[model samples]
Target: MQSTVNYLWHTDDLLGQGATASVYKARNKKSGELVAVKVFNTASYLRPHEVQVREFEVLRKLNHQNIVKLFAVEETGGSRQKVLVMEYCSSGSLLSVLESPENAFGLPEEEFLVVLRCVVAGMNHLRENGIVHRDIKPGNIMRLMGEEGQSIYKLTDFGAARELDDDEKFVSVYGTEEYLHPDMYERAVLRKPQQKTFGVTVDLWSIGVTLYHAATGSLPFIPFGGPRRNKEMMYRITTEKPAGAIAGAQRRENGPLEWSYSLPVTCRLSVGLQTQLVPILANILEVEQAKCWGFDQFFAETSDILQRVVVHVFSLSQAVLHHVYIHAHNTIAIFLEAVYEQTQVAPQHQEYLFEGHLCILEPSLSAQHIAHTTTSSPLTLLSTASETPKGLAFRDPAQDIPKFFPKVDLQSDYTTSKVRGGAGGSNHKTPQISQKPARLSQRCHTPNVVVGLCLPIPQPCPFSVLPWRFSSVSGTPEIEEVKRVTELKSRLRALAEALSRCSHRITETQLRLSNLSSELLKNRDQVHADRSIQKIQCCLDKMNLIYKQFKKSKMRPGLGYNEEQIHKLDKVNFSRLAKRLLKVFQEKCVQKYQTSLVTHGMWMREVHETRNHLRMVSCSMAAHNTEAQGVQESLSKILDRLSNQLLQDRAKEAQVSPSPAAPYPSPALTDLVFHMQELCNEMKLLAFDLQDNNRIIEGLNTPPSGS
Candidate 1:
């Protein structure tokens, strides 16, 4: 071993001694780097060769950030002794720190964080790399002091490390007694001595114990003494309260150890500077691992909080504006067109105005049409044509307007009438009044003067004013119609707004659900992979047990069966039964392993699908929310416009002269308003329902326990 060490290093300084090996601080002559050399005392153990081989195999393959680096191995003359070269840590073991007079009691918060972080990081790294540091304790961890006085921790000692698959029975109890899990002790007591099996969860348990020690400056379960007392304390660790409770109990019994006699004074000073220490410590000391702030839960909670913060930061007002503009524009156009059509106008003029901007038309019309038709003037000619026959006669010049005129001719007969009145006097002069037709013609031809007679004006009918009054009344209905249309539009807009908001919320929730599912799957896959390794290990353990039994039989001459007898026994039916039993057990193990794999795979797939579905739903919800927001804005705008128009219409009605013939208000406007409100309410309810469903789906997608 000395010669082998010489070959790997220039010089070695003895640092510590153990029952099985002597540890030396050495400088690698070839690389000019410091390294620790552990030389095994081969002669001290019963199966030294096997132990050395096992340790070497495990250490060579085990590579983790927290674990000590195994550089090389050397064999001595006659292959009797073996030396292992590893990375050197100058700060020595955690055991040294704990034993120091300045830190004998406990480390403060800041110092504890550093220690815990390093240790957990190392352990997590090991687990990630499929290695378990079965013997984690203060002695196995080395703290390296840097030039700047900062300390770096490294996990050491793989002498007791076993590959997860190695089936060799570890009859000799390993690991520090106080940190051993309860199952280890139980397995040791079983009659058949069932092989001990453990996974990465054991490392976490050790970490919990280590944390307790760091906090209290004493092993959580162990009382001061030697290995024997430590063993008794381990029994209590397995059977008693959690690590924190144990530490607390010990602290109470020992009284407060002073800083000078325990941990460094700087540790306490550093802890006092931080306000978050108390809550952090409480979380770390939680009894239930599930409840503790582990990686899974921490990430999940952080993500949720961040999402909410982001939503709060970004305003959603723009969505509302867009909806309001659209709704108002549409409603106003429709009302204007309806009002224009109600006025008495020529068909051609009505068409012209309909095509023009006199009314807001449907969106599809050409700009040219809008320019031509919209006008405020009423068609008085058409109104008069419909209201009176006299107006129609003027409209049609060829009609009989002369039928109301009288046909009268008075010219030559007037002179005859004068002669008759003076008949008595003219009797004597009648013979002198005779005249010829030619003479009369000549008299008439001398330009006769005709006088025009004015016809008496007809009396005014009471109902003649009705048409004008009706026109005034019609104006009221037009305003009412506009108001109603606006109200309906407003309600529709509100409904849309509500839906949009709900949709947005749903979308966010779905995203969170998806992430949760992914994490859950990853965790399950890890667990399944671990189980596969365990099944193989179990099979090998069964084989080893058989080998040990066979070896025992061979060592006892009387107990051993004769070669001929053994051959005969192998030929017997019992041998076949034994072989069958082995095959069955092997199959059973394989089946169990396969079943677990399949179950986890299916579960992961289901979780992924469910999350994806939830995400889609959330997206839908977000869209709905956006729509709802728009609807709400539109509704508000429409209502405002409707109210304003109604007020204006009422004002216009008040200004118009009221007559008995005035038209009544149209009820369509009121009905439209009522319908719109009902629609808006229904939409709001639908959006709310959608939001609720999305929330429920998100909840379902989250992992029941882990996250």
Candidate 2:
């Protein structure tokens, strides 16, 4: 506290430090809310730099939900001690979340999509505002501690953000080396500024690289080692790392892994995500700037993919999405590679663990019956060249893996699987441990909520073209029953959160009604206004019913449907299910909220019209006051002349007879003076009327005024 830079901000703890400035977690003395302050030691800067000034200007002007907001700049301690107070993200960096091996299962597919969508949205905002977040790395993207939990991520760090006018190309080279586009990377490596110019498209390239790295938990383009030379190293880059290829993309031949050719997309992914995302990465990873898309083009393509359910993967990062498609022609080898990625233990050390049948998930009935369905116990993978986890010195991974469903069940890999519920297993397959319906097993210390098990997914294309049938779960007890029930329990908790937010809105609306009434009273002095209080109350009550359902969820986990109905489901559409659920808990809310939203629109129009009216009245008053002043000035001169004449006449009368009340020379003169008094009184009355009008207009425009 004693060494504080600003009294207005109470600097509590140091958050991070950069090359030029240090960031501190500080509290605003006035608001008492926490903020982050990037304090710069101006002694080194001496004079304000262009880039730094632009950073502040850009931050102050932009207002996007996904981008971090800037509050103000302060130089409290002295002129040289400058600080930029900005919004704080207490949940920390996205890099920390992605890099942690501790997140063994990693982030869920739904969560990963949510993060990507948010980041892209923020980038689009920055692009539209004529700014490029040159540093679009994981370190700059952070999760905010918000009402939506830690799922909301924001893009920050404008230190290297570029502000360009239309048709302007960026000439300066600034940003982290790892995230730089190929052209920028070449320039940095060469240590000499080239005449080549680039646009904000560099940012899109960076984003693509960033996405790939986050998905795989490994960098897509790591610079190879060199003899640390100043200028000569750039020349060496060409000979060192493999360019124009998927460096870490994993591939399995019948014998060994072509590890260098593939990505680390080792995580269990959704059915077709591997194919969907591979081209996206390639589209963004183009080396030639001409072929690459600008901001508008990038948004169009990326948004289309994001709107659909993104490729879901668990256990693996984005690095390996390529492998699934690359080896699709031969499903046998691809199946082996999937196992290698899932184990997190390399293929070499743990081939012995999978002894039973390696079953794909259920395929369509027509595909099942029409295709040759043979049960083979042979799914041997590349036992020698599986990419080992980063830190293992030697030896094999022990058999102590986490408890998982057999038959290569991969629920976590993608957001949703397309495979239908159950298909008959016709092959004389061994009665597998995979066939048993998943039972509820309590983890270390979870609540009464039951855990879910994922059903297996069948291989695609060439694998289907192969003569193999996916092992099925025993038909006596359905897998859908277990999954639907368990999924229902977890989903109820999320629905409860939604209901709570709705209740908060209803309460806020009620408070607004009170304020609105007082505001009308101020404008009219005696007032009445229309309000939809009844409808709001109904919506509130409906929301409570939904919340109550959450409370009783443990006993009645069914979503108001019988087991018989759910069992009949061979295929399910979640969008339709969600609509039905909304119909149940949100009947009144949907109807009333829509009506209120319309009312809100009308209220906005009225408020806008009121402001315009007040402004017009103020202008009209100014013109009227000018006319009044002219009349008053003319009247004053006449009154002054009359008084002077009377005074002179009175002096003459005093000489004849000493008298306090002097007589008028003529009756006509007395009548003229009376007329002057009448005109002055009329002017005074007009002044009072104008004053009252101004007061009313002012009160109407402002917040509810005092009595």
Candidate 3:
């Protein structure tokens, strides 16, 4: 059984409870439509009448998808209590999502973007209506699952909101403590006795805090004690000049605060996204309202991001993956052109496969629509040609290799094809090919004169028929040989790329290692345990020197004493004085001196042990890096040979006449494949070694268990 709120709506469940009102999931009995009913309690009714009136008026005037929809206002039957029926958001608030353990580090990029777009839109609407939602934290934003499965965030909880224009100011303080601006925090949270007026930028401050929290799971400007318990410190942190602009106080009292302008490594957002996003965050989170970005600039930048289409593409020919962010509203043709720019594969040859079906290459189709279909997986880019069928094993490589050697074979053919007139005015005749092995360049142009291959001329190969030259002799052994040559060439290029990436990674590792070593040495020198003991020992040495200097001096008459008193300082009195002084010194300094000696010894032992371990680790790393460099040199040599062999094979393929039953895999092709396999294995081993070395370096960089 459901309880009736006003006999017209049935209250099925209690949605949430707030300070002044209790919300419930209610259904209209007459229309059978679900809605959220905000039933105001006695406390809510007791609030300032103007505030109540303003909230109702603001809600009534505003209308946006990003803002919760207000349905109707009704009164309860029993006590004639007032209630507001609004759009029901079934997904709850963003706070619940952030509270999950998986999101402890922050929301994932996609979800964070959803939050960003929605909040910006909602705030834009509020500004347009001349209302400031003084409370703009995550809890005030409700979530709903759209028909397309995207999250729709709506700004809610308007109890603290009011009408305020851009130039106008409001004296009332209202907002969450953590997200509050410094001026508001000073007056509202710290309860300082000061009067100040707030403009529309207060909402920007709250939005900044909300975005930071959405990007990084924790609030900014945290104190050693929490924001509530140490309100003064929080205020100081927020108000501190210069560094505090993009800084947070240490959560614990360990050392001086080290301000970082960048987000932590734990944040899930990519570096490219972070670069664009950090500037927005910096602008919005500005401590000075004058320096902060207004709604116009903020909207401009954020809309720029929202408008970009990010397409994830996978290349079937090269076996590489790419994320293409197109900065335009692109059609399918434009999108494919963008992919061609990234992958170097022509748009004509590009065929995309989404959800195991061929994506229509209609030029008018929207790229964003295709992206939506492939959200679960990347769009597969396939190489296509008219001569070779789509499922051929070797056609893609054959089609792609010409892109690499577009001029090499053609130039050789042109240069070696020219024939001079015979001495007796007889016409020169082409020679017949033989079975004997010959140099590739000599064989290519011995039969015909093909000139002007290197110069800027129309391409000798017609792209309409086939992308490769071997298409002239299709269904022959020459085609098989051409396929084999292209395959090996493709493998060689891939290997070279792998080697380059490996070398780059090694260089980065070496740089990181050097930095870690420098940091370690600096820390050892500046923050060493022995330094404390050394300071104590230095103080003791100074004390001993002063004592000796005093002992060597004669009894001074001018040492703040009368002549009779000085004379009265006999040996007995002096001995008694010395004894008391010694006793006090023993009580005060002797134990400390002993403890310092022990500490010094312990520190020395630990330092020596650490140094020895570090020395061994460094020696091992040096040896490993030396071996890696040697392997890299060897791989480079192998790659050069493979490249030369591939060029020669292309030249030979251009010269060889078609045969019906020639061997499928020639000895040269077999040998080429073997060398490639060897190079690949060596690269794999090198990769494993580099990974191990990285782990070792990482271990050294990691701080000791409980620093």
Candidate 4:
């Protein structure tokens, strides 16, 4: 029979081909949106109706952002084949992306994080929506590219999806060979023997395999060939050692040359990227499902790594853009050579001023006399003086010379002088000439003097061109004091919160204790009632045995004697029997009397012990009750103190305003208050029940008298 479809869309361009279906790029005429049409071949071994029904049942209920959307399904006319219309992804499958030259065999670490996050997000969506994509691989995932260079990943292939129901059992072995779970492969290998039940963990296993393949561009485990050959692989997967162990074993067997690299791509990544990437990949590809991180956990970790990468890249770009060089020493000196040179003064004058010493040179003074003068007075002069017959003549001197010359104060201009005739003198006359004392100021040349300025350097202004100068002034001490106070306040708040939580937990524990006491009382009552019933049953059995003996005696009749003879014989026998019975009864009475005495003694002892135990329990209960009451009162007082403290802190905080803002109460406080209230209610209920139980127990102990 020829099937008919509405022909909503058609495309001649084949997008991809799977095992049972061929996908084509098409456009929905009504919606005018591009869509992928997946056509199932009717000529395949699978029954068309069964496949369509199964696919429809799963796809109709699935609704998630990550899972592919199924728009419509129809039967085509000529081939009688079922077709699925799905959303068309523009960027195509992840498999194609990984295989592309742009990605270079595998994605870079940063881009890998992005792709991994997408995959995990999709898997998490599927998990949350009670669906497990049994075949989660790069080929089954499509990435849609937006105009802003953003990508959206969608998980496709609903034909392998299954619902997550606790009671439901899945036995069908269907999935790609490369991504099949060990359990599924086991079931397939043992198909003729017995069927095995597997849960959604199989999907996790498959996801692990898919993640391994995605990361390394190769499967973690590979079979030789075919289903029978795959059995050996499954056994290896289930029973053999891990990948690390296998690699180690291979190395041991071949002495390291067996695993040696033949070329550069023998190991796809460099030594460093591999060391970091391999462990991360191993965590996702763990054989144990429970040990492996779930979709959400994986995505959360992956997103964190991605954020770290983004921050790192941003930091690198910032470094490159700013291109600032930092130096420990002052480089500003290179730009201010003129200013620095202006500050440089001669060191000789500085030494003279600081050391309080001077040097002088006179033409007539000898070197020995100059050294002697330096030893006597610190102002030393090295010069030579010419002596005439009557007086000494001096060279040119300034007007202020005489005022500073203390030694020459006695010498006056009217003093007798001697004229020297060293050059040419026709008549040698004794002319007296007075020699002027050397002035202290004439000892040193003042023109060559240098003075060192000791003035402090001017600080840079706020708006100055100095790079290290601050733009605004701050009261640092005040800010620090405020921060310290804030920290103290936060710690106090935390302490109060902790105290409140402890009080709540104590109340809850008290409530639970009271409930347990009540339950213990009820159990004791039931045990007592059951014991009484057992005793009554034993008594009834004894009475039944006595009645059966009486019935047996009444059925016997005299066989061989007259009435008088029988009566006399019966009387004689009765007398003898009465005597023997009396003796036996007396023995029994004595035995019973002894037994009663022992029983009475035991009962008295039991009563005394019970009384003592009850007293001890009462005392203990009283002590415990007192302690609990004290604790409750103490907690109430502590809570009140905390409340008062909190109010005072709030007031103090309000008075001394914060720079930014005061932190608000944590949202956890509301939950704490609610829990505290609930605990108080529960404690009240438990206390009432405990009181009732104590009363019931008291009543059970007090027996009725004169019954």
Candidate 5:
């Protein structure tokens, strides 16, 4: 069917083709993200309208990690075409892996089990919602690559799936011949009674077959490819046990799991997996549909797998399943009381059954209720108008409850049959479950099986026996207080690392500010030295001028040849070499003052940068900020003292020489030197105070010992 979808999706090359749809590698135009597009040739479908609509209804309702997500749907009116935009699985389907010649050596058991559990988890969710994927085969299961050498498997191809009402059954068999349940095949192909149909348990049979094939590298049953041979194969599926087919069927190492009456089986499952799996296969592959393990039962029993399939239950209604995993052995009554209080149900009339049937009140005898994954404990509870039931129960063992095997301890003889299997070969079927479905019937209104899984806890069940029943582990418990505490510790360490980064930044800011303040002090001291040099130069100039006057007095009528004047001039005059030294010192002092001014500006820039950063780190860090303020106040006081001293020095200079051109006499020069020395002493004290401030800042910058 040719059509254009929304401008948002850009269709690319075809990825793969299926029976009713063609999958393409596409990109979301808005996000540039890759996605898989399943385009349906609605005109070519067996029940085109029903298939298209049913898939849409089913995908929209389901939301799970193991279930393929349906992002959007598109349809074109003219061409009878429909599109399903979904999450892309790059690695393709499990069927492809099993069939590929490259994987003839077989997949690692670890990788295989992980993928198996993921598929089971998704199937459990499907069963809970009353939906069944009638066609669950290797081809229908897709594998997606995940983080760190892990892979996730999700159930796809819901075209053959449907959600049945409690009274409904899948009488129309529409899947591969090898994967179909015996009951479904008999009714559709053999034209058995239409009323005789199967429930969701059909999917369980397929799961058992799929897992068996994945592990053993061969199907448990012999293939009857043509129409004439199909009848013989169907009979075998109905009568032959899985143990028989596996013992006498075909084998291959690097090809499709081909099995025929003419070949021998090559078992790929490890002993540990075989011990657990063989019994499961024997039970699930049972001819009587009701005798096999239900989907929920399979999930619960497989808990002891290498990759434990943790029970995760989700609900759309307000009904919440709060898990209370108790380690210590306790009375069932305490747990019930706690649940009753938590849900705020009335306290006066509270009657609970520890191990009995659970019934949900309904108008019809065939309406299906929600499915729950129950523990090995056969406990059940009857549903009421209020979902918060008074109690839970276990089935009466005398009648029959499909039993769960104890943890498969496969260290020694895995080939040895399980407890029930070794019980003298009597019909290994649970009579109660085989009787009828767990609907609101007159006789079996509340059966042993619970419909949905919620609040699933494992082993040594606290809700199995009577209110006063105790567990085997009273002192030492089964459940841990907390599993994987190391993960939590790592998160805390990440938080600590973030805090350290913040502290380091603050320390760096404070250090820069301290360095700037120290540099500013050095500049102020350089200015002081420059002023001293200028005062001494002024003294030398005064002496030179007086010496010139003494020499020029020779032309003066009376004072030209006066010995007294010459003697006085010689006593005050400085040597030529000494004068040259003074001139060079003054020039050096000028350069020093100029360099200090530039440095002082740089110090100001550094302070400005610190001020900008301080806004972020300006938390009232108790001791550090307060100490910084104290140092600032001390610096302010020193600046004030220096300002006063400078003003005093200016007054002294004005008083010592009233005229700018007048030379200072001996007494005046001595007074000027003494005053300048006093000013320099005060400036030296300011420098010392700046050094003290630097030390204080250093103490504040040091990190706490504990940190």
Candidate 6:
């Protein structure tokens, strides 16, 4: 049973709800096109007539990809109430995306940029039309999935908007408290007796707050309590904080206050992006009205970044993201080549898909193939080659073989046996192990041979036919050599076990360190709470002391009044007490400020020490891995020599006999070393992540000294 709106739109699903209107997802009967119908409630009619007409006229006149389109305004069949048919955004609002758990710290860098570009473009359009969207926030901005699955953000919800030029001013207060201008906040939210008019820069303040939220998950100026519950504190933070200093406080019930001055470590934006972006935030978020950046300057700075091509290449094979930045004029070939540099996949072997469509690459197309790609919907890179690409395949160990063994020197052919019947008394010749046991194996089998595995077993030890070597010695040469190889294998196994233990230790240390850091952050919140509570207590004590004196003074015999006079006097007394309380709080909170500064300094030092310890652990793990790799490489060479010798011995021996000897199963030593190096690389990446965290912490902790 679908409900119909305006007799034309069949509505069933609800898109969103607000104080004045509820939006529904509807479809046109004739066209079968989906649309969003904004059905206003009775409360919306209570507004001034001019305000009601302004929203429809503004939406009707504006036309831009970044601004939601107003299709038609009609009256409902039953109630004869006005309903606005608007463009439907399937992806919902940016607010919903930020609410996702993965984005709790903020949007990923690329997605944030997309939000930035769209919002800036939309605002520019609004300004050009002499319209000021007084109530600008994430919820008012809707997202639509564009051609390539790219997200297109459009400014919507023009209910609070009005046509006001740069020179004009708006006295009426409108906007969410957290993102509102301080002047509006003082009169509208705080209910303070002050008259202030807002200029176009008010939108800039909202934009700053909105951008900060999109870049880092939360609002910039948050008090110990929230904006609504403690409006005065919110006002104070917004007005008192300098430009670029984000102030947030956290606490448990009755706990100390923990104040933050900069972006959190959890923010996903990269430093490079932050360097360009922080200044924009600072300029627009300026508390001083005159100092804030206008729309032109904001657009100019953002346009520079938006003009450069930013392509996010997603590797479907490895499930990795590679961010590539290039000029708009660069060709698709250069783009693929850049992807190759990052992924090690050859350009010919790379198959890319954009929005589920196979991209047709032509040298003439230029960079348009990737100029519009975004992180939300990236170019999917797939491998077409069956075998591993060049530079990615394992190296051949034979090429690395040296000319001589550590204890015994051999001929260039890796044989040490001497021939009796030659021009010289004893000419060296590569020998057959069955007829004459190779001197290389004979020397290795001897107890006197000092073969060091750490030093390369450079020459091949072809001990294949040493068992039938016809030696005059008591011990069998084959058995002795086998014993030595078995010993080396045992040592190699022990080294591998040590490496496994080290990896486990590193994992455990990382977990413990992470837990410690979480606890430290929690403690800071408690401290903030305690300081806030202490300031309140001090203010209350002074207020109580003054009230007692006032009560005492009023108790005099001369203090008498009628019922009407007494009531009026009571109101006066309350007013005086309120002003006194405010004064007391202002004077007492100075100590809290000093205390917070000291606490912040201590917290920074602790974080530095923690980061230093993390580095130390990373270095130790790297050294341990280096030692393990050295041992593995040595064993790899020995195993290769042993496997080759056994194969040769069996082949030679099989020619003489009808039966063949059992074959030995050689381990994949090369693969083992490759995996070990991979693990080391993974650990190095973890170390880099920790370093990134430290840099974010430093950025947050070290605010401008003057600030």
Top candidate, metric TM-score: 3
Model 1 — TM-score against the truth?
0.35
RMSD of 3: 31.2
Residue 509 C-alpha lDDT in model 1: 43
Note the Cα lDDT for every prediction shown.
0.43, 0.46, 0.58, 0.42, 0.47, 0.58
Please state the error at residue 97 of candidate 6 in Å.
Answer: 0.8
In candidate 2 the C-alpha lDDT for residue 631 amounts to 53
- Candidates 1 and 6 compared: the better one by TM-score is 6
Q: Using Cα atoms with residue i matched to residue i, what is each candidate's TM-score against the true structure?
A: 0.35, 0.43, 0.48, 0.38, 0.40, 0.46
In model 1, which regions exceed 4 Å deviation? 5-12, 30-32, 43-45, 48-51, 62-65, 77-80, 165-172, 185-197, 222-227, 230-234, 242-707
lDDT of 1 by residue, 1-707 (tens): 25464444423467666678888877665666777888777553656566657777877776765667888887655555678888788878887665442243356444665676677667555544455667777888888876888777878777766554222223444565556555554454322365655544444456556755565455544433322434443344345554323332222333432111122222232222222233333343344444455533333432332222000000010000000001122343432333233332333322111111112233344322222110122111111112211110001111101111121111111111111111211111111111111122112112120000001111111111111222223345444544544454444445445445544544554454445445434544554454433443343344333333333343344432465354234223222332333344345433443443343333324333433544565666566556655665565556566556556756766898764542435244444444545544654555565556545444432322311
Root-mean-square deviation of every model: 47.3, 36.8, 31.2, 55.7, 42.7, 28.6
- Candidate 1 to native Cα RMSD, angstroms: 47.3
Two-way TM-score contest, 1 vs 5, winner: 5
Model 4 Cα lDDT, one tens digit per residue, 1-707: 12234334444467788777888877655556777788887544365566557677777777766667888887676665778878889888887665442232245444555566677777776666677667777888888876788777788887767776533567777777656666676556545455666666666667665555455444455333323344554445443535432111121221221221111132233232343344445555455555555655665655544342110000010001000111223232321221122212122211111112322222233323222221112321111111111111222112101111122111110010000101001010001001001111111211221100111111111111112111132354323323432343343334334333433443443344344334434433443343333333333334233323323333344223454344334333323432333343235323332343333233223323433444444444344334434434443443344445456756776798665543334232233333333433433333343344333334323322311
Q: Write the per-residue lDDT of candidate 5 for residues 546-598, one digit (tens) a residue.
A: 43443344334443345545544443343332344344433654345335434
Q: What is the lDDT of residue 381 in candidate 1?
A: 14
Error of 4 at 534 (Å): 99
lDDT of 2 by residue, 125-193 (tens): 886788877778888887886785657889988887768754679777877766677678778755667
3 or 4, which is superior by lDDT? 3
Task: Arrange candidates, best lDDT first.
Answer: 6, 3, 5, 2, 1, 4
Q: Which ten residues in a row have the lowest lDDT in candidate 6?
A: 418-427
Model 4 lDDT-worst window of ten: 312-321
Which should have the higher lDDT, number 1 or number 5? 5
Rank the models by TM-score, top first: 3, 6, 2, 5, 4, 1
TM-score, cand. 4 vs. native: 0.38
